[model samples]
Target: MPGESVEYVVVHPDTPVGPVVGLFLLARSLEDAEEIGATVCGRALRTRAELSGFLLLGCEGRLVGPYFDRLLGWAPAGRVMPRPDHDSGNPFLDF
Candidate 1:
């Protein structure tokens, strides 16, 4: 949260309008995080997906969002799917 901090809470687009759930993104540039958040939220809208977190571009870590109860038939994504070029520790991700 220090070092050029940008703290924000973003709700997944799939989430219903009620008290929105939020994900936390911390970055050196608020603009950068905002851009990534917008993309993730937008993709969630189109995919109807639920994610616990996301890895930011040019960052070595990830920003975890809210967790929602899955519908009876829902299938979860890779808990910690890494980009081909990303190399970092994400405890939530299974090796």
Candidate 2:
């Protein structure tokens, strides 16, 4: 399992209407995915006051929305995709 990774969908669960933000991440486990997702979101909140109340809703193995199609277009089967760097700009904008 050296190169194994799973695709996860992370969202902000408390949105009044629905999750306006969706984060896609590749990680070794569900817990790792959630942590990474939360960390990324936390950093964004530091700069964007409007996102203060939002938090990482959760991470799930299933892909959702446009992220699914976007992944299929670029990610190869059974290959671990690279995780975004801490300073790699805003990932949320990519979604």
Candidate 3:
């Protein structure tokens, strides 16, 4: 199960309704992936007061959103993947 990977897309808190812009990461399960996404968004909300809120719009077993679309003109791709030598003590730093 550890070898298996799942891609999850989280909508940006600012645009929870549409335009779907947020972070994405690969994890072993939906829960882990969602937690990581939430953690990142949480930190963003804490440091950047501009953020309206944090929310998990949706998640799937495969990648989603306009990650590779040139016409969409979305921000540069920012994908978080687990490091081989990641520290289990700190999940946030695993990426």
User: In candidate 1, what are the lDDT values of residues 1-23, reduced to their tens digit?
Assistant: 23423234444546554334344
In model 2, which regions exceed 4 Å deviation? 1-18, 50-95
In the predicted model 3, the residue pairs found to clash are none
True-vs-predicted CA distance for residue 73, candidate 2, Å = 13
Residue 46 in candidate 3, Cα distance off native in Å: 0.9
lDDT of 3 by residue, 1-95 (tens): 24324243345435546545444556766677766666655556677766666444553334454554533454334433434433556434432
Best by lDDT: 2
lDDT of each: 0.44, 0.56, 0.50
Clash counts for the predictions, in order: 0, 0, 0
Candidate of highest TM-score: 2
Error of model 1, residue 30, in angstroms: 0.9
Clashes of 3: 0
Candidate 1: lDDT of 91? 32
Q: Model 1: how far is 37 from its true place, Å?
A: 1.1
